[model samples]
Target: MAQQQETKSEPFDEFIVDTEDCEAREQAYRARGTARPITVVGNPVLHKECRDVTEFDDELARLVDDMFASQRAAEGVGLAANQIGVDLKVFVYDCLDDEGVRHVGVVCNPVLDELPAERRMLDDSNEGCLSVPGAYASLARPDYAVVRGQDAEGKPIAVQGTGYFARCLQHETDHLYGYLYIDRLSKRERKEALKQMAEGAPRYETVAND
Candidate 1:
């Protein structure tokens, strides 16, 4: 099991959703009927670099809807298209920062702006992923980030944050580039994460096969 640790500035909230709104949206989605099965760590889709989303058509719109539905159903704060077996450069987030302010958006073909070297800060926080369910690891990531991308319709979209939200941005963007949180871990930490997965992955077999 991953040990808990407190941050100097703010405590971490691992992929927590806004309960009332998230549940309502999930219920609505269930009523309407659509949920994409989340891909797991071993899936090739999770390892391949996602392709840039070019045509913003009705198909893209529907994909965005399904992504949101799938994310809400899984109760995750952020999700990338690759996590759902889609090889597109898109991600959605309904995450919160250290102070509890909600940040929500869809980012397609994102370009990340990491903080300058002097301003960069690292936080070794416990992080989890929907794709790699039932396992968590302490990954060190920059404390702030800015991601510029587009909406489902290709309109400009940018999101910047600090604390956990910054971690979320980095994590999702990494997914677009064929990376996972475990890939950021040190060798020993990666070994522990893999062991945890070997033990707990069976619980998610049904979801993965879906």
Candidate 2:
């Protein structure tokens, strides 16, 4: 997804990395990943909360790899499991913060961290998603976000971000809990975003809802 702000990673190890290793780590995952069709907004899987990742095994690792592949293929900054029709609580992201520093990593069973007033500063910007392709709407989200979750191997990890990267963290986490960025928009804006998607199709293949 484009930032209207700005812009995954190691095996089950590196939870989050800065600009220096972001590209290389992301590439490593993408190289082994196979891009799958992104599921659209109306798909049933996209509408419901995803199941927690109970078993952190090779299968889960492979799913993370595939999510990275799909994110890159669709040119999105972040992607969640349900976006690809998987009902597991996981997502991959490669996004840049306000300072232009790129970050990449994976979060499984992500839970958002509550912020005190100081860190609750809001960032309002146009946001897009791979699922609701070709659509964007202005949304306000906490500029600084912290998400706690396990990695591919069930290792505890917490990721923190600011600016667009922060939005990516919150946005993807919401997907796991069955909420799209559009869902947070006002009724009119939500309608307009859907209209935008109808007017233009995404470049990548998407699952057609029944």
Candidate 3:
């Protein structure tokens, strides 16, 4: 998957709808808002394993671009292909904080080479996603992680993350494996979060998937 340079002025064409599914897809995409649930609970696209990335062609490149757009549109820091109903082992991360800085790259055909046998946990902070709409929770995750994966160019790359980046990587990786952030939360927390989801908060899932 080759990385495409996105101009600040021009909109991303990757996730945009075409003449075929414009109305339905565009409307469905718009329904997503910031409050959308992270798809942590209820029939999540987990269990089904994702295939590895082998080719880095035009389509793969386009998909990466769309993933970035979807992530940004959803106001998320990272996203995986599986979250958008594509069972490919690809994810995009914006190396930015909540303050809206941008460090960009694509992670393709990722392989989780290492995880701490003894995990280190952190506080449950608000987390959301583009798959499930109008939901969020203070989910717990590890503080550090080392992931070995391939870049868009098919080069073997290993990157270690700490702090929020580590947490975001783990969360997005979980999406690749069909896991949701809610799965990592306690039963009580899930109940509360689901309540907010039911109330229909504005979130990105509706916008991206629509």
Candidate 4:
């Protein structure tokens, strides 16, 4: 999950997660048990493109459930499969938009659509990743997006959002292509973000959330 800017100190606050929902999810995960450990920036799994998900079976269903649990446990609004070291084109999100509408679901092998350039709104919000824990940098992303994919059951799924949810969709989709939120940073910002990670982004064991 990428960090979002939720303060008025930044023009990108619209991209941040809802504080109340974040706490609620964390509590729910705590009650459920443990969360999966998040893969850090240095991990090879985070750098390579993920394989498409083909087997839509009980196994895929279980994986999606675990992903949702893991994301909630980490107090993140969205998470990609690779964030937990799974090299599959899948992601789970439980996020809110500026309107406070909750959007939750799983996306496998997603195809993203960005709004036309003239209609696109760029948000330079502060974004952080679970893989690069504790480090955050300003990133510009479109304010509206649509993603078409399938559910764990292979059913077609299409999600579209504005504001923060839009950012969440794009961020998670990028993970499938082996790109991190940091990769969207400007050259200078990317350098700084790397430095921050080098200084030590917190590392966690790939265990279930507690």
Candidate 5:
């Protein structure tokens, strides 16, 4: 019998995990007992472009809390609303080290800004999603990017990220656009990776209608 994997704890404070230590962060995600089925690429909620968040009340706060809870429960670095079957432009991230944990925040209505041309491409990195259970794939992404959005408190903000945060931002933003980690790979790679992912994974079907 296979050894049972240990699940991560909740109320993620970012202080416990150092995101700057890529190896350690990856290990944390890997340690997550199992991958949970996140809404897939063609799911109507994922495909239907999310609307800009307009309300900021207790309800929204609760949703934000739940998003964070889900991210922690899934042991993911970032999470988007669409992945959870909600068609809304909302995402939460905590890409920092134990010392720099406060940088983590939510992005409401995220819009990508001009990334320095020199920083556009990055080496392929292993990526996974909550929606695609038990699937991990290497995906190529930019090393740096600029994102503009509003915070949970409804304040406008612009942030620039490099390294892991940049990669995560791109991935989460892709979720908002109905793209999955597999879509970032080359056609040949996607074919092979997806085949392997589907073998032991639970069945998932794309939603036919948006």
Candidate 6:
């Protein structure tokens, strides 16, 4: 996912997760998982909508763990399953909100909620993706957003946030739907972003599309 610069903190205090416990929880997942090479923009897996995650078994659990490892390895705040070449509706995030409060969790079969016009406050901030490697472009996204999904164990949950965390949630969801942030840009902007990627190399291992 991308690092957002439009962190206008909203008062969603009731939605805040247990950050104190998140550090230990995040480490436990990362500890049990192996980091895999991330898939780049041209990969087929990243171009199509992902399959829904039906079985909440050990395999799914392990995938979540691996996603956290992969996200950390890529130095990204959030990642979707297809980002690692898995065509499943799953994503993991370890991001901080506008207030610098850390939130960590996994969402399976995630769905973003439709925001009403009143809540559609556009935050035009620069965004970058791990899959796109070294490109970034300013995009307009609602500062406040919400998502409904299940946990690693398949329990129902809803997560909402403001600023950077909101962008993380929205970004990962878009990945599962086979839409990169560049997809939202103008043709010129999109071409510019791809050109930037062509000129740079990712620090971490990446899966070559070819």
Q: Per-residue alpha-carbon lDDT of model 6 for 133-175, expressed as tens digits?
A: 9999999999988887788888877788789999999999999
Better of 1 and 4 by TM-score: 1
Rank order (by lDDT, best first): 6, 2, 1, 4, 5, 3
Error of 1 at 96 (Å): 1.0
- The top-ranked prediction according to lDDT is 6
- Candidate 3 to truth, TM: 0.68
Q: How close is candidate 1 to the true structure, as a TM-score?
A: 0.81
Off by over 4 Å in 3: 1-47, 97-102, 113-123, 205-210
> For model 3, how does the per-residue alpha-carbon lDDT over 64-159 read when each residue is reduced to its tens digit?
766665665777777788766666898877654334433355667654434433546564567775555567777766666555567878876655
| Top TM-score model | 6
What's the TM-score of each model vs. the native? 0.81, 0.91, 0.68, 0.79, 0.71, 0.92
RMSD of each: 8.1, 6.7, 11.2, 8.5, 11.7, 5.5
Off by over 4 Å in 6: 1-18
Candidate 1: pairs in clash? none
The whole-model lDDT of each prediction reads 0.77, 0.87, 0.60, 0.76, 0.64, 0.89
Candidate 5 yields a Cα-based lDDT of 0.64
After superposing candidate 2 on the true structure, give the runs of residues whose Cα lies further than 4 Å from its correct spot. 1-20
1-210 per-residue lDDT for model 4 (tens digits): 111212212334323233345556544534554467888776788878999999999777667767877887677889999888789999988888989988776789987754455747898888888877777987888888777778778876667778888889999999999999888777898888888867873655543322
Write down the worst ten-residue block by lDDT for model 2.
1-10
TM-score of 6: 0.92
Candidate 6, pairs of clashing residues: none
**Ten-residue segment with the worst summed lDDT in candidate 3?**
1-10
**Model 5: lDDT of residue 84:** 68
lDDT of 1 at 61: 72
Q: Write the per-residue lDDT of candidate 2 for residues 31-126, one digit (tens) a residue.
A: 988999999998889889999999999898888889899999999999999999999999989998989888888888898877766777888898
Model 5 agreement with the true structure over 1-210: per-residue lDDT tens digits = 011111111122322222345544334433542333356545668655687789977767666766666666666678898776667888877665223443356788877765445656775777776666567777777777556678777887666566667777777777776677787678887777667656855343322324
